[model samples]
Each structure stands twice: as structure tokens, then as C-alpha cells.
Target: MTTILVTGAAGFIGYHLSRRLLEDGHEVVGVDNLNTYYDPALKLQRLQRLTAYEGFDFHRFALEDGDRLQALMRERDIRVVVNLAAQAGVRYSLDNPRAYIDANVVGFLNVLEACRHHGVEHLIYASSSSVYGANTQMPFSTGHNVDHPVSLYAATKKSNELMAHTYSHLYGLPVTGLRFFTVYGPWGRPDMAYYLFTQAIAQRRPIKVFNHGQMKRDFTYIDDIVEGIARLLEHRPAPNTSPLTGSAAPYKVYNIGNNKPVELGRFIEVIEQRLDIPAIRDYQPMQPGDVPETYADVDELIRDVGFRPSTSIEEGLGRFIDWYTGYHQPISVAP
Candidate 1:
């Protein structure tokens, strides 16, 4: 069985992807620091599920620790590497920029170095939809210039794409960078708007509606993200042979999004409908590093991997609430 290494295996998307890999009978080596970004308990709970599988092996450490990461990759004989470890949250980055540099930039460099020396066959890493900063264009495309990033988090992720391209060009390491849109569903991040809004509405608290409820997001579901990543694992990029781009690099980037931009008001309305309660909406001005809307163009993703995220917000959020109720137990708060 081919062994693959997944960083940030304790985080939201990482946990889901690792579990999916284990269920497919692939040997997976998971690495995570399990920091108190939100709650270590939730991360541990997710890890506990993967630990149940015989093919899953986990190590607790930050990706910035190059020595440990290299050792783990070498020892595990990892054929593929999926680097998902990063200090997420755009607002958090504004407050703590160093965290983003330490995790997303330094940590990602370590991952690249490990893949290079260890002879990894394929390297798939997470890019962000936030990288399309200041571009008001409809349905952000990968071919568009992403030189401008509004947030430190977006800048770091954009840096990752550049770093991966360097590695691919220099060492012939095949790399695929996925620009994920607003991903939401079960086992979601607490800092995310969907989860936060759900919690507030459940507690009979006023939910903050930023930008005066004028925001739009292409909320791709977690299952769809996992499916897209799974399909791209085997489809490694080959060196570009086109004359338009002179450099021959085995690197590619794809946007994995639902391609359906739902308005913020409609999204909250869906949540209210699913939970059978109305939310106390508190309108607020736009926060820093916030975008007006995000709609991804997944044409390249479909052409390359033959898969596209198609989960509607209503169906996805319904599944999330069902899981949330069961996981959190009897709801004491108002609905």
C-alpha cells in the first residue's frame, strides 16, 4: 500500500481528508501540533477517529520543525505529501502576522524541502480563495494575476504557490495547489462565519452581519473538497511544454469551489430555515481584510480532475446542523 503524509491532520479539512484516505485503505501518516487555535479537544476528537484505523499513524509537531518533518517523511516512506498545516483566519493574521509567517511560510518551506529530499511522487497543498485580493472580477480564475493580496494570510498562501512553483521547476517535483473557496460543513472550524453564526443563533444571541449583509460567498462543502482532493491525488501535473510560458515546471493550480455565490442574507436565511428559528441580526460595517464576494471558476478543475464541487449551502448546512446537534448533545440554548 502506498503511504501518504498529511500535515495538519488534526485541523478541519485535514481531519476529514485523512479519514477519507484511511477508509480507502491507503496508509496515512498524519502530523499536527494540535495547538489551541480554537480548542485542542475538538482536534483530538477528530484525531481519535483516524487513530481507530490501522493504516493511520500520527505525530504531533509543527510543520516549521524541518528536522522532524524530514525525518517523518523519510521514515514513513511517504509517496505523496498533502500539506494543509497553516495558521488560518484572515482577521487572526491581521492581529498576529508572525503566526502566519511561522506556519504558512516557514512550515511550507520545510514541507517542500522534505518532499524534495524524500523523493515524493506527488505534492498537493492548500491555497486560499483569499489570494484573489482586490479583484472584483466574477468567478476568480487561476490564470489571472494574483500579485496583490489584501491580508497577510492571503499573502502567505500566495507565497506558497510561488514556493511550490520554484520546487517544481528546480527539482521536477510535481505539485498541485488548490485554491479553496469558502468551505463549510461538519467538523468545521470554529472561527469560520458559518460555525460562529450557527453557535450565536443557537444561543439566542445576535449574529453579526458584516458589510451590511451585502457579502457573497461560494460556500463549497467539506465532502466536495475531500472528493476533489481525492480525485487530484493521482493526476500529477506534468512539465509545461507551451511556448507562451517559457519555464517548464511540473506545477498546476486549480480552483475548487461550488461556483455558486450565495448572498450573506440568503445564507443566514437558509440556516434559520434549517434550525426552525430566526436569528437576531446585528448589522455591522465591513471588517478589515474582508472581501465583498467570492465566486470561483472551476472549469480548469473539472477539465483536469474531472470533478467539481456541487453541494448547495442548504443541503450542506442541514447535514452540519444534524451532526452539530448530535455531537454537542441536548441543546440547552434557545434555537
Candidate 2:
């Protein structure tokens, strides 16, 4: 069983990945600062479930503490590192740009440093589909140019890809970056559109339909994401010496998404159907740092890992709403 270190073990995706890893008999050392980005109670809830496993261990710390992180790596003898911890939210980053830099930039550097010194075999980190900002590219591909980023969150994610490439070039580290599209499902972040919309609809409140319901997102399910990640755990990248860059760096990026873009209005309609309650949509202009549409081109992910996310919005949302109703207490709608 491989000893895996998941940086954001308490997060929505991280928690799921850690649970899957533990089920596969891997020794998982999870680290998180348990920051109040959203709701720590939710993070704690996810963590509590993970702690029940025999091979699961938890650490309360931020990734920026390079010294402590290195110590943990050495202490745990961590063979593979999945860096998922970050200050998430595209709109939040506009005012809290420093938080993104401190966590995504400075914190990621520490992760790379720890991997470099700790003899880690593979470094797989989270990247966002937001990096394709202002591109207007249908079915965003890894080969497409992603130099333009509209949000600080997107910029930081792009920076992560660049930073990983640097380490892979200099230290021969096997680095793979997964650009996640709109990931939603059980135990999802409260700040996410899906979760927030569900809460609003359940309480008989108006759900804000951004861009006047013109938005589209490649909503990937949590299980599909975990499956993609689990499959890639052992499939490390090799050096690309194919005369493109003329350098043999073991670094690659793939878009892990459903490859199916669903309209915002249609998504809400599905939610309404499941809940048997009509939604009152507050159709508003697109907020700042928000994109109109997101579509993932998973050709590379499928070709490389032999798998891709295919969970339909109906099946995925059904499971999420079921979990939500069971886990959450009664909701009080605002008058």
C-alpha cells in the first residue's frame, strides 16, 4: 500500500480522494489548516468520516509552512503527494487576492520543495478550468493557449502548472496537473453554485441565475473526479522529448471533466424536478471574475489514463440532493 499525502484532505474533492485511497488500502496522511474559507463545520464533517478508517491520519496545518511540511513528508515517508489545498472561489479572489497568492502560490512552492527533498514518486495537483479565461474556446483543451486568466484564482492555477513544469525539468519529478471543471456532488462546498442553489430552492428562496441564465458549465460529478484521480495515481507522466519543446520534462496537464456543457437554466430545472419545487430565479448580470461557459476537452486525459468523467447531471445531482437532505438540518427561508 502506497503512503499518499493529500494536502487538502478535508476539502470536497480532497476528502473524497482520501476516502478512496484508504478504501484501496493506502496509508493516507491528510493535511489541512481547516481555514474558514467557507464553513469549517463542513470541512470537519468530511474529516470526521475519513478519521474512521484505520490507515487514515490527520494533521492540522497550512501548506505554506515549508519546514513543517517537509518534516511531515519525511516523517510519513510520503511516496505520492496530491496538492489540493488552495484558497478557492473565483469571485472571492477579486477582493482576497492575497489569500490566493499565499495559499496557491507560496503554499504550492512548499509542496514542490517537500517533494523534491522527500523522494516523492509522483506529484499530482489540482488546476482549474478557469485558466481558459476569455479564450471563448469551445471544449477547452490542454493544447490551447491559457496565458490569459481573468481571475486571480485562475492565474494562480496557471502559475501552478508552470511551477510544476519547472520542478519536473530541474528535478525530474513526475508531475501531472488536472484542470477540473465545475465539480459538484455530495459534500460539495457551500459556496458553490449548485450547493447554494439547492439550499435556496429548498428554502423557497430565489436562486441567482448568473449571466441571466446564459452560463454553461461542464459539471463533473465527485465520483467521476475521484475515479479519474484514482486511475491516475499509478500512471505517472514521462518526459516529453518529442521535439515540441526539445526538453524531456516529466510534466503534463489534463482536463478532467464531463466534456458535456450544461446550461445554467437547465441545471436548475433538473434540481427543481428532483426536489418537486419550482425555483424562483433571480436572473442577474454576470458577476465579475466569472466566465459565461466552460467545456472540457478530455482527449488527453482519456488517451493518457484510459478513463474520463461521464456522470450525467441527473444521476449526479440526485445523489447530491439525497445526501444534502439527510446530512443538513431543517432550513429556514428568509422572508
Candidate 3:
């Protein structure tokens, strides 16, 4: 069994990945600062489920602590390092720029450094679809140059891809960065549009329809994301000698998303139908740092890993709502 270190193990995607790794009999070391970016209780609740597994270990810390991170890497036989931890949310990044700088920038640097020094076989980290900033490109591809980022969150993620390439070039670390679309499903981030919309619709409150509900997102499901990740974990990129290697770096990026782009209005309609409640509607112009649409071109991901995300919105949302109803408990802190 490989020993895998998953930063942000308490977060939505991290928890799911860690659980999958454990189920596959891998030893997983998970770390999270348990920051109050969202509700720490929710993060803790996710943590509870993973901690019950025998193959999992937990640490509470931030990515900026490079020294501690290196120490942990030394302490564990980490064959694979999946950096899923980050300060998430585009709108929140506009409000709290410091968090983005601290976590996404400095925090990610530490992760790169730890993996570089720790004999890590593969380092797979999260990127975002937001990096396709202002590019009117339909079906965004990772092979495209992502220099223009609209949000600080997107900028940091773009920076991450560049940083990983440098590390891969100098240290020969097999690095893969995944540009995720609007990933949603069971145990999703509360700040996400799907989760928030679900909560509002459940409470019979008005769900803000952004950009007059003209927004479209390639909403990938959690299971599909985990599957893509799991597949990549096994398929580490090989160092290339050809010019395509772009300075001999063992680094690659791919867009992991459902090819289907669902409009925000139609997405909400599905939620409303599921809950059997009409949403009080609040139509608003698109907020700052919000993109009008997102579509993923997963040709590289499919070609490289032999798998791609295909979960339908209906099946995915149904699972999310079911989890939401069962997990809700007055937002009490997990003891």
C-alpha cells in the first residue's frame, strides 16, 4: 500500500480522496489548519468520518509552515503527495486577499518544497478553471496558455502550475496540476453555488440568480473528481526529452470536468424540483470575480489517464441533497 499525504484532507474533495485512498489500503496522512474560511464544524465533521479509518492520520496545520510540513514528510513514507488544500472561493478572495496570498501562494509553495525534498514519486495539486480568465475560449484546455487570471484566487492557481513546472524541471518531480471546473456533490463546500442554493431553496428563501442566471458551469461531481484523481495517482507523468517537454519538465496540466455546461437557471430549477419548493428569486448582475461561463476540454485527461468525469447533474445533485438533509444538525460543532 502506498503512503499518501493529502493536504486539505478535511475539505470537501480532500476528505473524499483520503477515504478512497484508505479504502484502497493506502496509508493516508491528512493535514488541515481547520481555518474558519467556512465553518470549522463542517470541516471537522468531514474529518470525523476519515479519522475512524485505521489507515488515516490527521494533522492540523497550514501550508505556510514549511518547516513543519517538511518534518511531516520526513516522518511519513509518503509515496504520493496530493495537494488539495487551498483558500477557496473567488468572491471571498476579493474580500480577503491576504488569505489567498497566505494559503494559495505561500501555502502551496511549502507543499511544492516538501514534495521536492521528500522523495515524493508524484505530486498532484489542484488548479482551477478560473485560470482561463477572460479567454473567450469554449471548452478550455490545459494546453492553452493561462496568463490572464481575473481573480486573486485564479492568479495564485495559475502561479501554482508555473511553480510546479519549475520544480519538475529542476528536481524531476512528476507533477500534475488539475484544473477543476465547478466541482459539486455530496459533502460539498458550503460556499459553493450548489450548496448555498440548496440551503436557500430548502429554507424557502430567495436564491440569488447571478448574471441574470445566464451563468454556465461545468459542474463536475465529487465521485467523478475523485475517480480522475485516483487514476492520475497511478499514472505519474514521465519526464520527456522532446521539445514538447518545455524545458525538460516532468509537469503536465489537465482540465478535469464534466463536458456538459449547465446554465445556472436550469441548475437551480433542478434544485427547486428536487426540494419541491419554489425559490424566492433574486436576480442580480454577475458579482465581481465571477465568470459568466465555464466549460472543460478533457481530451488530455482522458487520453493520458484513460478516464474522464461523466456524472450527470441530476444523479450528482440528488446525492448531494440527500447528504445535506441527513448531515444537517443546527451547525453545531463536532465534538
CA RMSD of all predictions: 1.0, 1.3, 2.7
What TM-score do all the candidates reach, one by one?
A: 0.98, 0.98, 0.96
Tell me which of candidates 1 and 3 scores higher on TM-score: 1
Clashes of each: 0, 0, 0
Would you list the clashing residue pairs of candidate 1?
A: none
How does candidate 2 fare on TM-score? 0.98
Candidate closer to the true structure by lDDT (higher is better), 2 or 3: 2
RMSD of 3: 2.7
> What is the per-residue lDDT of model 1 for residues 1-335, given as tens digits with 9 covering 90 to 100?
57889999999999999999999989999999999889899999999999999999999999889999988877878889998999999999888999999999999999999999999999999999999997988889988889999999999999999999999999999999999999999998989999888888877899999999999999999999999999999899989887866879999999999999999999999888877778999999999999999999999888987897888888999999888767764663563
Q: What TM-score would candidate 1 get against the native? A: 0.98
Candidate 2 lDDT tens digits, 44-123: 99999999999999999999899999999888889899999999999999889999999999999999999999888999
Per-model lDDT = 0.92, 0.92, 0.88
lDDT (Cα, 0-100) at 53 in candidate 1 = 95
Residue 119, candidate 3: how far off, in angstroms? 1.1
Q: Model 3, range 1-335, lDDT digits (tens) per residue?
A: 98899999999999999999999999999999999988899889899999899989999989899999999999886879999999999999877999998999899999988887888899999999999997777888766678889899999999898889889999999999899999898888999889888898887677888888888999999999999999999888887666754477777788999999998888998888887778888999988888888999999888988887889998899889888877763552122
Query: What would the C-alpha RMSD of candidate 1 be, to one decimal place?
Result: 1.0
Worst 10 residues of 2 by lDDT: 326-335
After TM-score superposition, the amount by which residue 306's alpha carbon in candidate 1 deviates from its true location, in angstroms, is: 1.2
